[model samples]
Target: MGLRTIGGWLQEQHVQLHMGRWLLELDDARAEREFTSYDDVRGLAEGRFALYIGIALTLAYGVVDVLVLDELQLDVSLVRLAVVLLFACAVVVTGRAIWVGRHLQVSSVVLLTVVLLMLGTTLGRAADFPTEYLTTSCTVTLFGAIGLLRLRMHAVLVMAGVYSAVCLSLPGALQGVDALARNVAPTLGLAAIAVVIGFSLEKLRRTDYLRQREVEAEQARSDELLHNVLPAPIARRLRTEPGAIADSAPEVSVLFSDIVGFTPVSEALAPEELVQLLDTMFREFDELCEARGIEKIKTVGDAYMAVAGLPEPDPDHAASLAELALDMQRTLARLSPAWPSPIAMRIGIASGPVVAGVIGRRRFTYDLWGDTVNTASRMESHGRPHRIQVSAATHALLESRYTFSDPQVVDVKGKGPMTTYFLLGSNL
Candidate 1:
């Protein structure tokens, strides 16, 4: 082989000698993807990973002790001490794994490995213990580092490098070439395979975590859309049991408003300008409703609809609607100075029992049914420009808290002469 080829091979061997460096050389993009998933599912996976690894480590130590029991030609007291030390290490590592953070957990594992390595080697030298036993025990420990512990790539790699090196060096140095060849080669091969397996498992874990997050995100978005389309209580009911929604609210207040001169203004302006004007005007009305905690039902061509105390009961629903009416009048008056032409609103409000429910399936709407809704519409249609009209029901509810014009007998459509009053302002 060429010198450059030999040099490249040697460099490859050096990286294999240190698994940490090997992981660093591996695909970084793959590592980042796996880490993102690992971070997302840490709470769930940490306990599972720790439990399995703790069991594996404890079992590994037991097996090693049993295998070397007959071969340990040392003082009984020293052997007992060694056994006590190994068992104690195993117990400490396993217990700490349950509650420690990721970094500390990795540190605990490394500490256990180092303690075992030092204890085994010290005992081996004093007793003339077989190199094969020590090599096997150490190799098993390296296997557990990558295969069982399931730490981050760098942590596992650092561990594998240390144990694998000790297994390779100590056997050949103390025993012979035969021991080195038998122990080191297989340990290296197993360590490499374990690293690959660990990485694959991490990738798989990340993919499953990402999929679960995607499902949760979609569910949240669906809930948000439902809430936006319907009232909170109604939306919740629909989620639990979806069907026709028809319920009579014992009492509620409904308000309807229409632009005073929209037909003429729409004809004068371009479609975009007209739409923009309506959007701006209605947006302000929406803010006023929101501020008063009223629920906006929907807006028709040039009419806006809102309600109070239907989805949930409010004792002062009428007062709240009255405040919203005065605010709407003030909002239009302030904006009219900047408009291309004079703009005004004709508002109507009624308070009474009404049946409210969602209508249609594909393009659904939450609307009210009863004479109360019709009267509110009539209070808008038959009323004068720049005036907020209310039926006797609404007027009675707000008469104590708000000022109103003298009651007038107006000819309401469908319902002949009805006593209504014009809302002037709030007492506050």
Candidate 2:
């Protein structure tokens, strides 16, 4: 019914799809919506307008050819019939040009040019003598020059130059004064307009391309950041579902770890040295969390918080937490010799129902906000250095898979005396 419900069903069935592969194509489509360059817009508009003009000119030329031939009382023959057939073909070509305007592709301009050239050639052949030929030639050359301008500047100039040469040479062939003068002014004027329009259109296209690229690059960066921070499903939901918050549903296991004497250690070392040490340790910790499919919430001073069932739920949350706690202890032990001071860590893990959600209005953080979070923090504070402490709830869930030693009932501040245990090793 809905995208999220469909996605949930797919996930439940263990189906995986390469949805991210379509991101680039979607981004390109979005980029097309914004105008990046003035030149591109102008080029697109001009080309479309020129196509419509070509259609109108084609119709006008067809009507004028028939009327002029009829007014002259020209003998109707097979040759005249052929000219009519050519005019019918030109009409079809013009209809195609009108259809192509919707796409505004450069190839459409090329097609229109071909059509105009064919019409011009047919008209030239149909004229009786050199005088009639010169008149038809001048009119055809003007239309051809304008049509060629719709494509590119170089193409337009080339077509205009060839047409101009033919028109100038026509007067000599016909020995007419009016035909010679008609060739010069109109040809030069049309050539200037074509050059200006072509260059302007090219500039617009380049500007539009650059702007679109910028928008696409920005959007890609944002998507990458979102993926890095939130789980794929959560991120996608946040984007598509309005006012969706990270929901806390079933029981989840939360773990917190802190160096026993981090504050004193910080006092002894320089600021930069302390930062370097923390950076190295946290970087490794992050890697381990990722390897174990655990989510690192955040670090506050010396305390590091992580969760086992979040963004997505896992029934093996307690086992996962146990594995993480053991790994953390081993990792800290290995790094002790390299540190300025012997670093000892205490880990507290608890599995229970917690209200977890992204908190804050501006700089938000995904955090658990329930008595379960409080109990976990207390467990960490009460834990012995170099040992993992588990609450009764966690112990119950993990007792079957893990061997834990019963620790004496400890006086936990607000919660009073609570039973705790030390995680030894996994049963398997």
TM-scores for every predicted model? 0.76, 0.66
lDDT of 1 at 418: 99
Local distance difference test, per candidate?
A: 0.70, 0.64
lDDT of 2 by residue, 318-419 (tens): 898899889888889888887778889999988888876665656656677777788888889999999899999999998888999966698999999999
How well does candidate 1 score on lDDT at residue 178?
Answer: 69
Clashes of each: 0, 4
Q: Give lDDT tens digits, candidate 1, residues 1-428.
A: 22222223333332121134444322234434444445534632443464455455545654555455655343533544554565456555545554344454355455646644654555455554566666565665555544444455655556666666665555244356766567767767766765776566555554554455445555666767887788878888877876888889878999999988888888988899888878888899988977888999999998999999978888899988988888888888887766678988899999999999988888787889998999999999999899999999999998988899999999887999999999998887
Lowest summed lDDT across 10 adjacent residues in model 1 is found at 1-10
Best by lDDT: 1
List the candidate 2 regions with Cα displacement exceeding 4 Å.
1-113, 127-180, 219-246, 291-293, 406-408
